[model samples]
Target: MELKDVDLNLLLVFHQLLMERRVSVVAEKLGLSQPAVSNALKRLRLLLGDELFQRTSKGMEPTPYANQLAEPIAYALSTIHSSLNDKQSFDPLTSNRKFTLGVTDIGEIYFLPRLMVLLATVAPNVTISSVRNTAVNLRDEMETGHVDLAIGLLPQLKAGFFQRRLFHQQYVCMFRAGHALDKAEMTVDEFCAADHVVVVAAGTGHADMDATIERKGIKRKVKLTVPHYVAVGHIIGSTDMITSVPERFARACVQPFKLRYVPHPVVRTPIDINVFWHAKYHRDPGNQWLRSLIFEHFSDQADAAA
Candidate 1:
């Protein structure tokens, strides 16, 4: 409990252990020997007066005390590291910083191209890597600094986070440019009778469009399902099957994929897209700069407001 009684280095080990759970895995990740990691754990246990982890068939499982300590300890370590490394101001033009973003498939299709062009001119040395984003693990990933920013729809970010509205999107049906429905006004019956290609975002096997259709007691004749929106264009552009996608993403895919978009027959509220970051990194200069860059290039406040 006393700062002097605790070896600050143990916190780093503890944080790694919290993530890896198994001592051997933690040791490998931290570049420490197994015995060293074990010794650190022993010392941490004595300092905190708790059996921080319990060995089980499922590897090392955190005790309730360790679970309670994980977030705050991770945040504290992250803050310390950021404060020590951050320069007076972030010079994006010259800094060689790599940022990891958690972005949905649709977002990646729509935003990454534009962002990369802007970064190329303004921050040539900076780089970006994007991973699939999900609401389930977003909070923990952000809290632990595993993901720098999560850009997409994240209704799960209820607290301890800050978000900015990037844009609002509505669904529209897309098909090959010369498909039978190309210029015809699509009726509800025609929309339901046509074979459809559905996009299951992030391979989750669920679609909001399907849910909305089900709510309206409308069953779509789904012919194929693909995991990413990027593939939807290809599958739909070459076949009679149509897929509904976010309007902006559909528009972007139109020319390259030789597809045409029509208003979706379903009447549903538009989905809100937002960029989220943890409160811990809210003011970090590097994070602030990257966030601002994204906002400036991608955010559509006028459409979002409307």
Candidate 2:
């Protein structure tokens, strides 16, 4: 189909459907009647010659064709919106922008509290939402504008993505303050023999700490495997199990619960946490302001720690 023959507004409707995954919700978001949204979806399907979405128990799942169209449609819409608003300045103080971020449980522990405080003081109208970072298709999620930013040790990032290193954190061995192992500095042998709680998120590989131990020809026995770091702390507190966590998080956990950090016997490779965004947003004024704010907040944190 020719570009002139298709309604450009249909693309906007298609984008909303892709993001919300439900026609009724998309209609509510766009302030259009449900029938209007359904009509637009039908037009989009005809123009694209594909059933863009298939009804699923969870929601409307995107077809392969719809997935392929997501990025270019989002880019086009963003470009059009930016061009139309070229004369208007982005006033963060008055603007209510919702930013969705993909972050790991460890990131939520180390960064969210301070970040929220900063936002409260500077951009009170801005809102933030965070989802777990899995070892899945993050590049697609970023490119399609599903997630505004991702914060973590992303091992493999695709091209055309911009990344800024936030900070490097080392792992520390943590145990209850009066635990038997807390009497001395933790040795690799002792760490491997201790009953451990391993935290593993979906799609993320098996525990990096365990992998490090295995490389030393020692096997670390995991007494339990939990989905998030938040649960790991609770389990460690109630039981005699030890867990290796990022130093910043371990420090925070040590304060409330009677916990102590013993130096990790294995070589601790500092995990580099970085913020990543699509290159298309690199020079956008709103995006630039948000990125700067994140860096400033994290920089202050590093200084305080030092």
Candidate 3:
């Protein structure tokens, strides 16, 4: 089809239909009457030469052709919408935007509380969702707009992605208050020999603390392995087990759980916490505003902590 002959508005209707999977819902989302949306669907079917959607008991289901066209069509509509909506300034206080962020448990503990406080003050209408960062297809997720931003110690991120250093975190040893280990600083042998609770997420390897210990030609005994760091504090508070985690996280977790923190004899290597996004969104105005807000919040927090 020639570009001049094609009605681009039909693509918007097609995208809404694919997203909602129901004509009625798509019509409501686009603020168009059902018959108007149906007419647009008919035009899309003729333009694409395929039945884009078929009625089923589950609702409107996309045909194979529609499935193939979904991403490209949605991406095109997004680009056009962004271009037309590009303004010199963004009023976050009045905007109701939802941002999806990819972050690790450590980040959720160390950064999100302060970030939320900042958002509450600056953009109360803005919503935030945090997804777990595991060993998965991060590059594809960011490229396809599945996630708006990722925060973690991402070492092997793909090229063409933007990464900004948020802060460097160091390791600390955590145990229940009044525990024997908390009486004094922990030696390497004591740290290795202590009954330890290891936190490992699904699809992720051993914890970073383990890797740091291994490099010193010493091996630590992992008495238990759990999926999240939140669980480690619970187990450590009840048992004689100790865990090594980021100092910021340890500080946050200890006060609530009545736990104590001790300095480890081993040299603490700093973990780089970074904010990553696709290069496609590098120039997007809304995205730029959000990124600036995150940096400002974290920078202020770091300065206060120092």
Best by lDDT: 1
lDDT of 2 by residue, 158-245 (tens): 5888998887777888888789898668877788789988776555432665677678787778788877888777778888999878
Candidate number that wins on lDDT, 1 or 3: 1
Which tens-of-lDDT digit does each residue in 10-71 have in candidate 3? 88888888888888998889899999999999988888799989999887899999999989
How does each model score on TM-score?
0.68, 0.67, 0.67
- Cα RMSD (Å) between model 3 and the true structure? 15.0
TM-score: model 3 vs. ground truth: 0.67
Q: Which is the better candidate, 2 or 3, if ranked by lDDT?
A: 2
lDDT for 160 (candidate 2): 89
Per-residue lDDT over 202-294 for candidate 1, one digit per residue giving the tens place of the 0 to 100 score = 533236657788889988898887767767877887899887778898888999989898888884478888888999998878899998888
118 Cα displacement, candidate 2 (Å) = 1.5
* Colliding residue pairs in candidate 2: none
Score candidate 2 by lDDT: 0.81
In candidate 3, which residue pairs get closer than 3 Å at backbone N, Cα or C atoms, i.e. clash?
A: none
Q: Candidate 3: deviation at residue 276, Å?
A: 1.0
Worst 10 residues of 3 by lDDT: 200-209
